[model samples]
Structures are given as C-alpha cells and as structure tokens.
Target: MIKEIAILVYPGCMGMEVFALTDLVLMANHLAKNMHPGKFSALRVKLVTLRPNPVAIAGGFKVAAQRLRGKPDLIVVPGLEVSRFGEWDERFARLGQELKAIRRFHGQGTELASVCIGSFVLAEAGVLQGRRAATAWPFVSEFQDRYPDVQIEKDAVILSDGGVTTTGAVSSVMDLGLHLIRESMGSAVARAVSKLALIDGGRVSQRAYVDTALIPQNRAPFSTQVNRWLAQRLSETYNLCALADAFNVTSRTVLRRYRQETCMTPLQWLQKARIEKAKHLLELSSMSVAEVVVAVGYHDLATFSRLFARETGQTPGHYKRLFQGKRVATFPRG
Candidate 1:
C-alpha cells in the first residue's frame, strides 16, 4: 500500500497540477480508511520544499510546505516554470538538489514520479534517460531536444519506466494517481476513490484524442466511398454484399480495403459508428435503453449491451447512470 506520499513544491510551480495530485491522493487515502478500518490506515501526504521559505506558484499563489520528518514512499514532482529570473534560478537549483535526493531515495525502494513539465526536472537529474516517458504535448519537442536519450512518447497520457513514472499535463495527473492507486490497492478501492473525487476513470483512455494528428487520412477510393455511404445510413443495417455492391468490388476486396484503411472491417466500422452515435445520444438526450438501441441501429438489446460493454468497458445502462449522476451532482440545487 502507498502509505506515504511527498509532493515537491517550488517557486513558479503550476498550482493546479499540485492541487489535482493532492486531491486524488486524499481521495485514495479516504478510500483506504473506509475499506481497511483498523487493519490499515490512510495515506500520509506532505508538501515538502527544498528551500526553507514558502514557494510562490504561478499567478501569485503562495504555498507553505509542512516540514517532513522522514522519507516518503513516493515522491511527486509538479510542473515548474522554467524562466531566467533570479528567483526562478534559485528555485530550479533547489529543485535539482531535491530531485537528486529523491533519486538517491529511489535507490532504496522509493518511487519517483512527475507530472507535465516536472519531467524536465527528473530528466535533468538523469533519472529518465532511455526511459519511456511523456509530458505535455506542447513540450514534447523541447523535451526530446533537451534529452535525446529519453524516449518521448507524446501519445501516452502516462508512461512508467521501472520505478519512475511521468504523466502528460495537469489533468492527466489524476489518471496517473488513480492508476498507481489501483496498482497499490485494488480496482475496487481505486474506483471508490474515483467516485469520491467525482472523476470518471474511463476518461483516462481519452488521452488518445491528443494524438488525433497521428491518424493517417483515409484516402483509399473504396474506403472513402464506403465511409461516406455508411455515414448517411448509420441507422440502417446493410449486409456485406450490399456494401460490396455499393463499392463495385468483390466482398473480399471490400473487406481487405476497409481493414487496410480503418483497421476494421465494414461491419465492424458500421457497428462502431452506431455505438458512437448511441453514446452521443446517451450523453445529450434522455433516451431509454430500448430507444437508444433503435436509435443506434440495434434491435437486439443483448447484442447492444455486449458491444457497448466491450467497446467502453462498461455496460450501456451503467454508463448512462454514471453520466446522469454526474449531471445531477453538478446541477445547482435550488
């Protein structure tokens, strides 16, 4: 279990990232206390500073670190502003020393992690060389340029190399923490923590949206025609022969071209499109399960349930319930 956690704070650090990490940690600890009772306890977290004085975060927010008496089981480095100002240099140098000390601690079973630009500090400490890591997409080029040995993967929201972990941007840090919590505790505990934090663990995979540019454009003539035809008739069920006829090709040729372009067969793509439409309706409209099934071109509830769960890792009803619950929680009570 992750009993002790330390957060590194320095001048010009991103306040939101630190707050998000701390919030998730607090949620995990709360779940631990509730689940374990007297057998185990909550996670112990502390905000520690390399300098003796309080650190001023970006936008003039000052945070005072409580003194830590011992080494933490996990140390987290939040993003810092890399500037050339005098205070910036002082804090950066102190952060470097702090990272060095944490690396030394890692040599003795402690784990080191970072969020967003914090990876730069870990890289500077020589802990990320040749390690698979990720940071904010905007910093991907700079990080690669600065540390050529580090394998920068911008597509990943979080990457772990041995004991060192790095996450992309401030929001993704919550996913990283949740992942660590799941690994340390169990899925049930992590899910409870996510519920308490009002965070949807499923959104972690949406990090792939940032890599949309990496997807190759669909330029194949048959694929283009099939996609266009399918887009117009998403609410209609079409057989493979019908699809092949529309494309003026044999079924095998159509299947091969579809798979090559979209990495999915014609029927699979159609089902995915329907599922996507169903998800949108679930989010945007108050449709019943039966109605949604028809709206998404599925007449069979069992098949829809199986496909929805397979694609989203949750049943359609469960997804609807979670989404509705989130809206109810966020709406202002009169």
Candidate 2:
C-alpha cells in the first residue's frame, strides 16, 4: 500500500524546512525498499501548492508546486520565514481558499500536520482550533494570541492532537516526517530512516536552542539597562535586593518593572541568561560539565545539572554533545 503525503508550499516558506522533510520522507521509502524488499513501498510525497504556480521561498530560489491531484493521506504544512511577528495571520488569510481546501481535505479524513510557524495556517484554517498544537517556541505568544482556543505547547518538539500534528522549531519538520514514518510503518523503519538521514533521535524539546537574550524585552528604559547589566555579568552571583540597589530602585519596584516589561521577573531572567551562557560555553569551548557549572555561577555540580536538565530537557553533558560542532541558529523569540 502506498501512503500519499503532500507537502504544502507557498511564497516565503522556509526552503530548508520543506526540503529537509521531503528528503527525509523519500529516504524512508528508499530504506524500506532495501530493508524489506518486495513488501514495503511506504510513502509517496508530493510538493503541493494551491495551484500549479511558481512560489518564492525564503531563499533566492523559486520552485513550482504540483496542484492537488487527489486527497492525500497526510498533508504537511511547512513554516515560512516570519520577517515580523504579526505577518503570519495576514499571509495565511490571503490564502483563504487554500485554507478552505485544507479544511476540506481534513474533512475527508486526511491527517493534517504543521511544522514550526505553519501552525498559524492550520489555526487560521480552523483545523487546529481548540486543539493542542506545537510550533516554533518564539512564536508561541503570538500564536496563542491569534488563536485563543488553541493550546500552544512551546516546549514539546512535536505534538499530535486529534487529527492534527505539530512540530516545534524549524528543524523539527524532519522529526515530524520521521514521526509520520513511525506511525505508518513502525519503529524499525523509522530508526533505519533516522540513521540514514543522520537525524538525532533524542530531540524532544526546543528549550536548549532558545537564546534567552533574544526573547523580547519590552520594558522601561531603566529596566532595559538592568537587563543589559544582567547579561554582562551572567557568571556573577545575583540578588534582587542588590540589583535594586545598583539600579537605585526598591526591590519591589525592580521586580514590578521587569515583570511588566519582560513578562518574567528578574530572577527568572537571570537564570535563563546563565543557562544560555553555559550552553554557549558547552557548545564552543572544550569545557567539562563541572567547569561549566561553576562558570555559570552554580557552585554545586548536582544542582547545576538538575537545573540544566529541568530548563533545557537535557543533561549538561548531553546538551554539550548535541551541539559540539553544529552551528546553533538564533531563533527570535517574538
């Protein structure tokens, strides 16, 4: 049996997300043929668009997507490069006819899945409305604001609810493809595909990739200075009272202002900043985990390890190993 899958393409879509998923799904089919010849022809993937028109993706390249031939068993909606925070809804709304087509396909029992910011399209189309979904962690706030009924799980790498599946961050689109393979074939096929694709199978969250400093900090001028001050000295010990004194404000005032601007208190931001710095050191420098703990202002290795694991969903060593030579992309937290 051939399981048909459609990968939706549109103008300004993330080319990498679309390309990676297409390759992974095709690789799964290739592996299946070699591993279980004559019995497995698992997936048939199509790059689809609303019409047979050329679409400009994020990069400089342009490609034509195939018009919908028939109702596919699964539809993969790929994310786009969001230049600004509020543009997703407008972009998706302009494709209202396509959104309607997606909903109709879902009505016909075609499973819907979204990658990263593509959740906005699914939500706008009403396919993911009132359901738990996952998308790029940075866009969680805006996504929730746009669709109040949709529960946004920013931490999870992938989430499946009802008939819609969503994956967090840009790279997890490949993970979502592998997940589809696991669902359609089995774990054995999925594992083989992962090995062939060189995809790490342990990515479960987007937390480790989150750069805390990049998170939006809409605050007062004085609070902005304080945030900068905190960023400069992530390795130093911090106290709310001392921070308030250094900034010539009462502790209560400091806490209130920071919370008002950043949506997080000073202490929470400080911890996040430390973790980010630690992540940087672990990835770039050949620092041991214990050295990293002390360098990040934590004295107890066990305490740092626990906090690191809790915040990033990976141990210090595991986190270091994950990005040893890889370039960590900075995702804007809108």
Best candidate per TM-score, number? 2
Q: Model 1, 1-334: lDDT tens per residue? A: 5677888877678888788877887777777777876644666678887776677877778899965447787888888875432233355565666767766776777788898878888887778888998887656766786889999877567888988889887777788778878876778888998888777676543332332233334578877789779879888887889888877889999888788876788787777778777776776788998899998788999999999877666678877775653543466789
Q: Give model 2's TM-score versus the native structure.
A: 0.87
Distance from true position, residue 233, model 2, in Å?
Answer: 4.1
**What 10-residue stretch in candidate 2 is worst by lDDT?**
211-220
* lDDT top scorer: 2
lDDT of each: 0.76, 0.83
Against the hidden reference, what TM-scores do the models get?
Answer: 0.59, 0.87
Clashing pairs in 1: none
